[model samples]
Structures are given as C-alpha cells and as structure tokens.
Target: MRPKIYLYGDSITEESFGDGGWGASLSHHFSRTVDVVLRGYSGYNTRWALKVAERIFPPVESGGVPPLAVTVFFGANDACLPDRYSAFQNVPLHEYKQNLHSIISFFKKRWPEIVILLITPPPIDEDARLRHPYIENPSGLPERTNEAAGAYAQACISVAKECGCPVVDLWIKMQECPDWKQAYLSDGLHLTQAGNRIVFEEVVKKLKEQGISVENLPVDLPLIANIDPQDPLKAFQDY
Candidate 1:
C-alpha cells in the first residue's frame, strides 16, 4: 500500500486542497509515491481539535500501516480575542500550548514512527479583517490581531521543541515580506495563493529533512520509462 501523509488542522488546512492550495501542490509533487490525506476542520481551534482527535485520527490496527507523516496546523482561531464575536474559539495561551502538546502526544502514541510537523498560524492583518469581516462581526472590530496571533505562534513553536518535532514557523516567515498583509493573506486570517506557495515550499523542505521526499519514496507501480514500446504489457505483468 502507498504510504500516506496526513494534513490535520483548521480552516487554513481545510482549504488547502483548493485551487492554488498548498495541499494540492504537495499532492502533485508527491504523485504516484504517496497519498496526502486532508483532515482539516473549518473554524476549529486547538481546544476543539483535542475534543475531536479520536474521531478523526483513529488508532492503527495491530498489523495495519500508520501514516508516514502528519502536519498539525492550528492556532489562528485560538488567537481570537476573548471579548470578540469569535470569542467562542479563543483558547487561553497556556491552554493553547498544552493542547498542542496533547495533540502531538496523541499522534505519537498511535503512530510511534510517524513524523509529526507543527505549523504556526499565519500573521493577521487587522485592516483586511475590517474590510472583509465575517458575516457576523458583532463587535465591528477585528476579532484577531497579528500580535495575538504571534503569541500563539510562539506557543506552537515551544510545543514543537518540547515534543522534539519539526515545525514551520509560518507566522515569522510570512511577515518577512513587506506586503504580507495583502500578498500573503486573503483575508486578515486566511491565506492567499502566494501564501499557499510559501506553505508548500516550507512543508516540502521539512519533510525532505525527515527523509520523506518524493525522491526517497518508491512510486506505487512501474514507471512508464520501464515499459518497452513493443512489450508494454510486460511491464505491468510483474507489478
């Protein structure tokens, strides 16, 4: 069976398979070698992720194969202001860190050999949030702030270090651009096509570091190059 890579997170991850999305890019890059599974939950925070962890990531059977790798990307919603309309998604800083640790532990316990990667939340753009607010912006203010998001991003990094897992510091990386607010982020919170590319590149780099790259993995079946023009049927016979 082809090995699998799981993308587990919130809306950012949930929309990662759309046009010009990072997940789609990964799928294309690793085509014929591995299966990239999408298990993102829209509007979910770390707190909610913990609640639904078991249901989404069930244990592997005694003899079943576990996923080759998993990416945990959350914290955008968790950084929402406690007093804002999106307060329902706000998880305190301390709890947010603990929740991330727990999530990693859950995956490690189930798949001892799995390569877990943590992705920090992208930076926020308050002006964009005001320009394109959610349908129910009761407070008429940005529910999230870049500063708050940065704090959560730091927490995510700390958790990754504590658990000895690789991490994608998206928050800091995205801000390296001068116009990140408009170029990288679609809304104040979500990612744009350019932003998705950044994610795809970073993820590929991290996976490669852990020895899970396309070049390292075997293709599922015989390559076309191996088939002879006069005896193409011979190639699949032995497969």
Candidate 2:
C-alpha cells in the first residue's frame, strides 16, 4: 500500500483540496507515491479536535501501516477573541497550549515512527475581515487580529520545541511577504493561492529536513511504457 500523509486541522485545512490549495498541491507533487489524506474539520478548535482525534486517527498500534507523516494544524479557531466571537469557539491561550502538547504527545506515543509537524496559525488581516460581509462588526473591527494569532503561533512553536517536533511558522512567514494581506490570505483568515504555495513548499522542505525524500519515493505502479503487450503478466510480475 502507498504511504499516507495526514493533514489535520480546521477551515484552512478543510479547503486545502480546493483550487490552488496546499493539500491539492501536495497531492500533485506526490502523485503515484503517497496518499495525502485530508482530516480537516471547518471551524474546529483544538479542544474539539482533541476529543475526536482518537476516532479520526486510531492508534498505530491497533494495526495496519501508520501514516508516514502527520501535520497538526490548529490554533486558528482557538485564537478567536472571546469578547468578539462566540464563546463556544474560543479556547484560552493556556488550554490551547496544553491541547497542542497533548495532541503531539499522543501521536508520538502511539506512532513513534511517524514524522510529526506542528503548524502555527497564519496571521489574520483585520482590513480584509472588516470588509467581509459576514464578518462586519458594529465597531468596524475584526473578530480576530494578527496579534492574537501571533500569540497562538508562538504557543504552537513552543509546543513543537517541547515535543521535539518540526513546525511551519506560518504566522511569522506570511508577514515577511510584501502586502501579505492581499498576496497570501484571501479572507483574512484563509489562505489564497500564493499562501497555499508557500505552505506546500514549506511542507516539502520540512519533509526533506526529516530525511524523507520525495524524489526517491517509489511510484504506485510500473510505467506503461515498460509493459510487454504480449506478456502483460510478465511485466506485472517483474514489478
């Protein structure tokens, strides 16, 4: 069976298979080599994800092949400012940190061989948020802010360090770009094509750093040109 890579998180991840999305890019890049599984639940926080993680990703010890890699991307919803947004979705900073640590620890203890990557929440664009029809506030403010998201991102970074896991620091990296508000994020909270590209490239870079070579991955099947028309079975058997 082909190796699997799981992308687990919230809305950003749920839409990651859409046009110009990072998940789609990864799928294309790893074609015939690995299965990129999307385990995204839109609008979910770490608290919600932790409750369902076991059901979604069974312990590797239970059987079958464990995923080659798994990315834990949360914090976006958890970073929601309680005073502005629904309290149901808001997770305290301390709890957010704890949840991330628990999630990473669970995976590490369950699947020691699997590579884990923790992704920091990307920065939010207040201007874009205010312009969004559904996100308009009476005070002309956004429910989330870059500053708030940055705090969660730092928490994620801290968790990564504590767990000895690699991380994709999206919050910091996105801001480094020129006019990142327009260039990276589409709706202040979500990623655009360029943003997805950045994510895909970063993921590839991380995998390389972990000694996982995409170029060296074996294709799912033998090349058609290598098949013998007169002896199809021979080619199949050889492969």
The lDDT leader among the candidates is 1
Residue 219 error, candidate 2, Å: 2.2
Candidate 1 residue lDDT tens string, 17-136:
999999999999999998999999999999999999999988777777789999999999999999988889999999999999999999989889999999999999998898887766
- In model 1, the Cα lDDT at residue 183 comes to 92
Cα error, residue 10 of model 1, in Å, equals 0.5
Q: Write down the TM-score for model 2.
A: 0.92
Model 2, 1-239: lDDT tens digits are 78889999998999999999999998999888899999999989999999999899976554567789998999989988898844568899999999998888778877888999889999999888878724437766678888999999999999899888999999999999978999998888899999999899999899879976667778788767877888878867745
> What lDDT does candidate 1 reach at residue 160?
91
Error of 1 at 13 (Å): 0.5
Error of 1 at 99 (Å): 0.5
lDDT of 2: 0.88
Stretches > 4 Å off in candidate 1: none
